[model samples]
Target: MNHLGSHKLNNVLGQILLAKRMGKTRVIAETGAGQHGVATAASAAKFGMKTYALFSENDQVAPVYSISAGLAYPGVGPEHAFFKDSGRVEYVAATDDEAVDALLLLTRKEGILPAIESSHAIAEAVKRAPQLSKDNIIIVNVSGRGDKDVAAIADYLEKRNTKNQE
Candidate 1:
C-alpha cells in the first residue's frame, strides 16, 4: 500500500476524534479525490459512527480507482467497507458549491462537524454556500507547499483586485 505522510491528515483525524468524543452523532466530509473521503469514512467506521462523504461532479479518476482497490482489500473490505453497496454514503453534487451546501446542510440538520479539504474550488464554494450560523469546521488539504501555488494565487488576487478597481 502506498502511504502518504501528512500533517494535514493527522490534524484532520484529531478533529474527527475530538468531535466523536464530544458525543457527536455523525461525521461529514467533502473530497475532491476521495482520498480524504475514504480516510474519513474508514475512521468513522472504526468508531462505529455513520459517515457521509460528499464529492463534486469532477472527482478525479484516481479516487474512483482507489475506492475500487480499497473495496478489494480482503478483510478490510467486509467490516470497514469504504464504498457502500448501494452507494448511499456517496453524494454527488453538480458543482463544488453544491457539494459544500450539501455538507453544510448535513451538518446543520444532523449537528455533525464536516471536514472539507481546501482547494481553489472550495474557496469559491465557501463564498457561495449558504450562511450557516452553527459552527462548522472546514479542513483544507494543502497538496503542494504554497511556493507552487503562490504564482497562481497571486495571479488570481491581481485579477480580482483589478476587477474591483474597475
Candidate 2:
C-alpha cells in the first residue's frame, strides 16, 4: 500500500528512536495554529500513538474524551503567530456546542461526520454562512475523519441535553 506523503518517515523516525531510547513516550506540538489543533496532530501522528490505548482499532486515532487529549492545547507556532500578528489572519474559537452541532448537521445533511477537530472550522463556517452573499463560498478543511468520534458525539449530546434539562 502506498503511504501518505505527510507520513514521510524522515519527519518522525529519528526522533521516535531517540524518544524510545530515552524511555519516554509522550510528545507535544503546536496548537491553535489551524484553530483546530492540526498543528498538534501533525506532530503527534509523526511520533505515533501516545494515548491511553495501545492499539488503534481503525485507521485514525482512537476516540478521546473532551479536553481532547492531543488537540486541546495552548499557544501557536512562530509562523502562525506572525500571520496573526501581521493581521493576515483572524483566528476564531468555536465552542463544543457549535462544533457538535456542526458535526450533526454534516452527518444528517451531508452524510459526513467530520473529526471533532475539523468540526471547529465547520462550526465557524455555519456561523458565517448566513452572513455572506449567495455567491460567497466557505470551504472547511476536514483534515481528519470522525469514525472514532461517533460514540463520543452521542455521549456529548446526551450529557448536554441532560444538563440543559436540569
Error of 1 at 68 (Å): 32
After superposition on all C-alphas, the RMSD of every candidate to the true structure, in Å, is 13.6, 12.6
Q: Please, what are the lDDT tens digits per residue for candidate 1 over residues 91-163?
A: 2223434433434454467554343322333444455446654476555343322333335445555775798
Candidate 1 backbone clash number:
1
Instruction: Give one digit per residue, the lDDT tens place, for model 2 in 1-166.
Output: 3143333334444544555465555543332222223333444465563512122344344333342334654433333444554689898978889888888898899998789899888999999999999999888898879988878888888999999999
TM-score, prediction 1: 0.35
Kindly report which residue pairs in candidate 2 clash with one another.
none
* The candidate that achieves the highest lDDT relative to the unseen native structure: 2
Model 1 Cα shift for residue 108 (angstroms): 36
